[model samples]
Target: MPEFSRLEPHVVAEILRICETMLDEFDQSYKHSFRLTDVHGFGDFDSAQQLAADYRRKAAGTPESARERMQQFIDALTQLRD
Candidate 1:
């Protein structure tokens, strides 16, 4: 197995933390507006809100999957570092 130290763990942690924080913020925003049944059509805001809600649900339920994907990205970086 490749040594994990090929990648800087702190950098990995920071990137993951930032992604998780952004996703959490997205979840909160979606939860706050998921039930909005009306919008003035100024950007299809209603549909956008619904889409965001769906994405938030998916993201919340599959956070591990997201993290795994991020890990793969980090591994790719490690390859580059090597």
Candidate 2:
């Protein structure tokens, strides 16, 4: 891992902010998925299965996406600082 301690406070703050936004978006997506599942039918196994699949997609996809994004931001900021 990069020595984050060497990074500027503002850079650290921005990283934190980006992470917070990603978390918020993930939470919203999860809630929306649950709501959609409920709307289709509370006891519908198929709907629940679909939701599970979607969640799996999200879970599998989001971290790498977020990491790339954060790295891009870090690279850009580091370049600017340099």
Each candidate's TM vs. the true structure? 0.37, 0.39
lDDT of each: 0.54, 0.55
Model 1 regions more than 4 Å off = 1-6, 38-82
RMSD of 1: 10.3
List ranges where model 2 is wrong by over 4 Å.
1-5, 38-82
Report the CA-based lDDT of candidate 2 relative to the real structure. Answer: 0.55
Residue-wise lDDT of candidate 1 within 1-82, one digit each (tens)? Answer: 8655564889978877776665666455555443342333345677777776565554444545343444455555445444
Error of 2 at 67 (Å): 20
State how far residue 65 of model 2 sits from its true place (Å): 17
Mark the 10 consecutive residues where model 1 has the least summed lDDT: 33-42
